[model samples]
Target: MRYLVRDRMLAFHEEAWVETEHRQRLFKVNRKLLRLRTTFDFVDTEGRQMASIVKKALTFHHTILIKQDGENVGRISKRKFRIFGDRYKVTLRGGRRLRIAGNLWDREFDIADDSGTLAHISRRWFTIRDAYAIDVMSEPDWLLLVILAVCVDHIIEDREGEQLTNL
Candidate 1:
């Protein structure tokens, strides 16, 4: 399946939607306001919290914790060393290591592990700047993967001083 995401105007509190190719809203990413740390909450269309990514304020590496039901389900951080410049490493709660590598800042990349490539994410300029199209392959945990991609996007944006929600 393919989905689209659009960039939001610069704001301390930002909001955007994860939608299907047909433009149906799937999830909402909310960067909460007045928080000590940057937090992006994912919610279903019905307004139920699906997951959240909370940035670590003082970590040596750029790190964020993925939480569902108030429990950490995964963690993503920048790899100190990369043989080929793939910057982020995702460690799932169940001991799965997912590697993300490609033209990341350009919004094109792949998420993969020992098994194989899981998904391809790339920016699609559909008359709107900073739009992304995510093509999911045979991964059963596609939702998490989508959230993961968005989480990475959020982190990258923060790094570039685009949306410094924590401030």
Candidate 2:
């Protein structure tokens, strides 16, 4: 599957079966790095986990872009770790079953299915504080761009009352 998160994009594929296995690969790009950790878990509607299959961590590096309202923001270097198999037969606690196939790019991620359709993308930004405990510059300027992109895409997709959830 394929999806665009901000200026970043990712794609994945899975086999048709009750369960599948995925191999994790690592890469690096300049000063940026990615450590992707994949896992399988049964979760409830509240996102609580029921069971988890832990895997190894895949470390890599890549270039990432962060933009807000089509404007460029700051950038970040990141690494990814895959904690489980790339392929999984996820059985949600709600009785919904699906194959989880996706990857993480720094603070952004794209998850998709067999048809190369995006299920979701996530972006995050953090605030940094100093010795005086004063709020300093916000971390990950690109996160704002990612959030804006997701919001715009959500509006275009018109999922109806779908609210953005902070990670």
Candidate 3:
């Protein structure tokens, strides 16, 4: 007799970007983490302006308040948080979590279930290409490539913005 264990896992790649007259912000999703803490510099394509944002968003708080439609939902306190490198973890109120690892201007992310089946939540103009070998599971490789793309896109966008502003 064979016993099968059904482990439900979902994963997907995503990218986010915002364009403005003066600047553009982008982010890419990478691996998920239980806990993350780090700092990185933000530079344009020319590698100028070495400023950074110090972030410390974790998942150990007693209760995380999620507001929807200006209404407060029930408190959430038992979710896991994962941060690999400069990536950020996005958690929804409904036990669903999205691990994002790119920049605010251009990013790539994956939404998955606990068991690891990849899913496509949404896609935008930004691209999510798969490259590299990141983990034994063959998922991290693609995630890294996505992150790189996001960073490059942000740098280019920033450069363009700066040139326009100077004119």
Q: Rate the local accuracy (lDDT) of all candidates.
A: 0.83, 0.27, 0.32
* Deviation from native of the Cα of residue 65 in model 1, angstroms: 0.7
In candidate 2, where is summed lDDT lowest over 10 consecutive residues?
128-137
C-alpha positional error of residue 92 in candidate 1 after TM-score superposition, expressed in Å: 0.6
Deviation (Å) of 157 in candidate 2: 32
Across residues 1-167, which tens digit of lDDT does each residue of candidate 2 receive?
Answer: 22122211221321111110121211111111233532223233344432322223432421223332343332222223336623323332334333323332222333223444334333333132100011112233222322322322222232123333322
lDDT of 3 by residue, 1-167 (tens): 11111111344422222222133332222322343532223333453422332224454532333333344322223223334343434344455554433332333333233665242212243233322111213344333222323333333344468779999
Give the Cα error of residue 44 in candidate 1, in Å: 1.2
C-alpha positional error of residue 69 in candidate 1 after TM-score superposition, expressed in Å: 0.9
Candidates sorted by lDDT, best first: 1, 3, 2
Please name the candidate that would achieve the greatest TM-score relative to the true structure.
Answer: 1
Off by more than 4 A, model 2: 1-49, 56-105, 125-167
> What root-mean-square deviation over C-alphas does model 2 reach?
21.2
- Kindly list the per-residue Cα lDDT of model 1 for residues 3-80, writing each as its tens digit: 787657785568888899899998889988787888989899999999999998878878889999999999999954
Report the Cα lDDT for candidate 3. 0.32
Alpha-carbon deviation at 35 in model 1, angstroms? 1.5
In candidate 1, position 27 carries an lDDT of 87
